[model samples]
Target: MDLRQLSPTLAVSPQILPDEVPALAAAGFKVLVNNRPDEEIGAEIDHEVMAQAAASAGMGYHYLPFHPGQVTPQLITDFIAATTGRGPVIAYCRSGHRCTVLWALSQAGKRPEPEILEVAAGAGYDLTPVRPLIASLASRRG
Candidate 1:
């Protein structure tokens, strides 16, 4: 798992295996957020397996799957709530792109644009495509 710590309380990674649950728990992540739907990854390691692993490891699990480029505001709001609760958290999706994008969106109103962009960039995610949206969201909040 290539876990990238975006903030002290938030991290994002590519799809994690059931066996990786222990390491995740040991690393101080109290929550596991799955951003990929089973259909995208097949049933190989479905949410049930991941959820069981998370449960056994004593970490909370949340499934907020969204298609690529189809993230909704409700999803962002849910992500924000989950990430802010009992974290540090590790959210995952295929290659972690959607998770990173959602993280950036969720932080739109609460954080500065420069800080959000810098953090996303540091994590190997470019937010230029959604920068305008982020700015708009921030302005609405302001």
Candidate 2:
């Protein structure tokens, strides 16, 4: 897994395999968030498979799948729900971009947009396309 820490509590990664869960758990990740849609991959690495791995490893698992363009307010809300207070979370998608984007959107009101972008950039994701959406979300926070 190419894990990239976004914050003390959250990290983003490229799609993780079922066999990788135990090692991730051993490495201190308390939650496994699968952001990649099942339709995008085979059953070998689908959410159910990953969920079972996470369960056996005693880690929390959340399967919130969505395409990058399909992200909605409710999705961001759910992302926040799954991530907040969940010890250390490792969210994954195909290239880690979708998961990183979800994390950035979830931070819209809670953090400054520039900081979010910088954090994502440091982790190797470019959030330029979602810049306007981040601003919009932040504006609606009040």
lDDT of each: 0.90, 0.92
lDDT by residue (tens digit), candidate 2, 1-77: 79999999999999898888999999999999999999999998888899999999999999999785999878888
Q: Model 2: runs farther than 4 Å from truth?
A: none
Clashing pairs in 1: none
lDDT of 1: 0.90
lDDT of 1 by residue, 1-142 (tens): 8999898898999989999999999988899999999988767688988999999999999999978778888999899888995969999988888898888888888999999999999999988898998999999888
lDDT score of residue 39 within candidate 2: 94
Count of clashes in candidate 1: 0
Error of 2 at 87 (Å): 0.3
> So what's the TM-score on candidate 1?
0.95
